[model samples]
Target: MTNSAKPRARAADKRRRLATEAARVLHEQGVERTTLADIARAADVPVGNVYYYFKTKDELVLAALSEHSAHLDELTGRLDQLPDPHDRLKALIEAWISQRETAARYGCPTGTLAVELDKRADGILDTEAGTAIRRLLQWAEEQFRALGLPDPDDLALTLVSGYQGMSLLTNALRDPDIMTRQGAHLLRWLDSLKDTDPAA
Candidate 1:
């Protein structure tokens, strides 16, 4: 590649790395507590150089949100690879439950961010924060619909709500086992719904 194009590519790579680190920091320490310096430090980028990519912390937060949204889409695509809808939903639960330790320490990344952003005076970031949860909910709804459920939307909401609620409690109580138990319960619930026919 030309030298000019090389610099642009390197800059883009730095921005992507910074966005990833920002997402991790934001998940661990709410957006209010996360600073541009923290992200720069985590990403190993020069603090001053962060301004070249993001003028404000909010802009970085938006980039982090976009990064998370892309991750959610990728996860949905992975789950879709399972042939059985029930298996796909259970895999989703397992995927989140596997992060029980993190959830116990900092709470569900997406859920915590949504709650924090919703409380902020800035409405735009709050809406963007909700994108992750919305995507999961939409994916869950599609899985439920594929299972022949009549009220797939309600089931989807319930699944998402249950997962988020358990994560919240686990974090507040600092108990990773709470998520483990909840994951088992969710799997059982999926089993109960497996044979239900939408036509009936």
Candidate 2:
């Protein structure tokens, strides 16, 4: 029993390591450029081992995309700390921009992969990524509604679009200034809303 369990444990560990390395490679080089061999080298595993866990590159890419959802959870936790709903929105926006500043080369993996999958009409990963994004937007909308904001659903969707658009621009421009300016602008816009609303 102990010997049998050892192999299973090792296989689980190998899968975990491969998944982590795949995510890092996908984030750095994207799904198109990152190859299975590249992932194997980064993962410090044999190429055959990578294949043992994933039959094709698509599988690895999808797994990495799923792992990336954890990033959204982290953002949600950070946004939840703010007491005011307006501040929560601002904090969420600013924190995301700040994160993009650090993760510039990788861009937003969720958005990037979703866009790529859409072009190919790869329905499975595309649907998974879209679901994660929609969940985030829904959460933001609920926060806005809690603050009694008008058209919270529309505003939340708009904000999500703006955030992704800025991330793409920041990557193309390679300028932190754009992120800084855009983040401040978002905060200012929220401030204006707060000024008008008594509940805020």
Candidate 3:
């Protein structure tokens, strides 16, 4: 490869590794505790290499949030294949619980980042994490729409906010039981919407 190609090759490699390291650190240590040095350490690169890819800590945090968003998108795709709205909703909640459990095993970065980011006024909080949350909310709204719920967007936001709050509580409790206890209430709410058209 030419010298020019070498730089491109290195750039691609750094981007790939940085993304991977960001996910790991975000999942393991949360955003506040996650540093470029920490990501570099996880990626086995010099700290300077991190700076080479990300000019600011927020950039890396955004990257981590993007990675997490991509992950949830992938899950959404799987749930999309189910034929029944009820089944899809069940699967969605189950997946959420599973995700939380895995995060717990990895130390719950989503919960950590949400709390830390909530305190800041940065735009990336919306561009990064908020966008991902909206994607899921939109999907849930679609599910409600399919079930003949009126105001699917409102209902979906309710579900989304409820889950976000529930996940925070679950993280605080460090127990999956919270999900088990609350899952039925959410399911009933979704089910209730199916009995009539939105206008009805």
How much lDDT does each candidate structure score?
Answer: 0.90, 0.79, 0.75
- Residue pairs that clash (backbone atoms under 3 angstroms), model 3: 150-198
How far residue 85's Cα lies from its native spot in candidate 1, in Å, is 1.3
Tens-place lDDT per residue, model 3, 7-91, is 8998888887888888778767777777788898888889987788889888888888888788878988898899987678878
53-151, model 1: which lDDT tens digit per residue? 999999998998998899888988998988988889999999989989999999988888888888888699989888888888889999889878978
**Cα lDDT over the full model 1:** 0.90
Best by lDDT: 1
Instruction: Tally clashes: model 2.
Output: 0
Can you give the lDDT of residue 174 in candidate 2?
77
lDDT of 2 at 47: 91
In the order shown, what is each candidate's alpha-carbon RMSD?
1.5, 2.2, 3.2
Scored by TM-score, the top model is 1
Where is model 3 more than 4 Å wrong at Cα?
Answer: 1-10, 103-112, 195-200
Better of 2 and 3 by TM-score: 2
Clash totals in order: 0, 0, 1
